[model samples]
Target: MLRAGDTLVIWRLDRLGRSLKDLIAWVGWLKERKIGLRSLHEAMDTTTPAGKLTFHVFGALAEFERARIRDRTQDGLAAVRARSRKGGRRPVLNVDKHALAVKLYNEREMPIVKICRTMELSKPTLYSYVRAANGVTDGPPAT
Candidate 1:
């Protein structure tokens, strides 16, 4: 909606966006089109150098805050990695359980239903594990 000589008026700086960065970006876009901004509450007019400088300062502060948040998030993730095996939900099948299931399916000729009952797993879950162990990646055989 911006055009040369046009001005975007707002009740307050916050009316522009939720974040200072967004407001700054909007102001930059307006400036690119030779448009200006006016905030009633702030009584600031981006048609002048002083108003533009004020916006620039807000934008710089927003960028600094964003960097700090990113750094803190990285530190938090590192801390979590230091304490746990992995961050997600526990696996449905672990190494020992997979081994036992494979042994029953291959060596003992145990029925899938029996394996499911013994392992406290559903039939589909047992079949999936057995199929994976048997290298049957394509669905059950046509036979």
Candidate 2:
């Protein structure tokens, strides 16, 4: 547990806060409680005036870096959208595959396992296709 007049030593300053505003708030809080902050990687100590200034400067730079990263990610996403492309995995079941799975399920010439293996589909998927073909939206049929 941390107490007043205790020093909070950390491996890095970046791990202290999420953003510049957050870091400033934390620094203010520490100051009010008479707690010092020491960052080993940045070699910063908030007990001294110079160390405090350096830490603030580093916090500002970290915030700037994060903003730039956000801008780059947005630009990349916008470019992808402009090309009429979509993200995420492709659908597992399409019209043709759905039709074949339902046909195989209805014929009952093969075991469920064999049908799944032949169609490269899971047993649940095969059953769902059969249900959909039979006009069952979900669950067991009504009484």
How well does each candidate superpose onto the true structure, as a TM-score?
0.40, 0.52
Off by over 4 Å in 2: 83-143
* C-alpha-based local distance difference test score of model 1: 0.73
For candidate 2, give the lDDT.
0.81
**Residue-pair clashes per candidate:** 0, 0
Residue range 7-116, candidate 2, lDDT tens digits:
99988766777578877878888888799999898889999999989899988887887889878988887888899987555756789987987887788888889888
Steric clash count of candidate 1: 0
Distance from true position, residue 34, model 1, in Å?
2.2
RMSD of each: 16.7, 15.1
- lDDT: worst 10-residue window of model 2: 134-143
TM-score of 2: 0.52
| Backbone collision tally, model 2 | 0
Give the lDDT of residue 92 in candidate 2.
66
Off by over 4 Å in 1: 8-28, 38-44, 85-143
By TM-score, the best candidate is 2
